[model samples]
Target: MDVARDRGAVAIDRDECKGCGLCVEACPPRVLRLSAELNRYGYHPAEYLGSGCTACGICYYVCPEPGGITVLRRQVA
Candidate 1:
């Protein structure tokens, strides 16, 4: 695998996602997952909890809902 950029702490807004699971499925690295844990929306939004995502923007692009996810920058592999 290529060097995974430590793009700080990425996050997903559970309140925005409809639990469609598109982002999870769309992840090329399969780093996302649909959690049974529901949020304020009462829907299980996708979650990213691993490391070294490569910062490929796959999840960001896949998220149809705007402002659903936030990508940050980090200095670690």
Candidate 2:
């Protein structure tokens, strides 16, 4: 997990997403948004605008493909 802005947050690679909708289905905060743009593989995957996330890792764990989701929490430094 990576840290961002001391908000216990991380970054997500929207391009790597496969649009399986599992992440969207699993997101507890409803942070992940389905992009209208489709990837090279022809799936309209999910995208995070970095606003609605609640730091829940449901999207990360439920994603069928690897790198489809990433969860970052702030390090207690």
Which numbered prediction scores highest in lDDT against the true structure? 1
TM-score of 1: 0.74
Which sections of candidate 2 miss by over 4 Å?
1-10
Best by TM-score: 1
Worst 10 residues of 1 by lDDT: 1-10
Residue-by-residue lDDT tens digits, candidate 1, 1-77: 33354454458888888888877777766777888798986988888766656566777887789998877666554
Query: Which RMSD values do the candidates have, in order?
Result: 3.7, 4.1
lDDT of 2 by residue, 16-41 (tens): 77777877777775667788998887
Candidate 2 Cα RMSD after full superposition onto the native fold (Å): 4.1
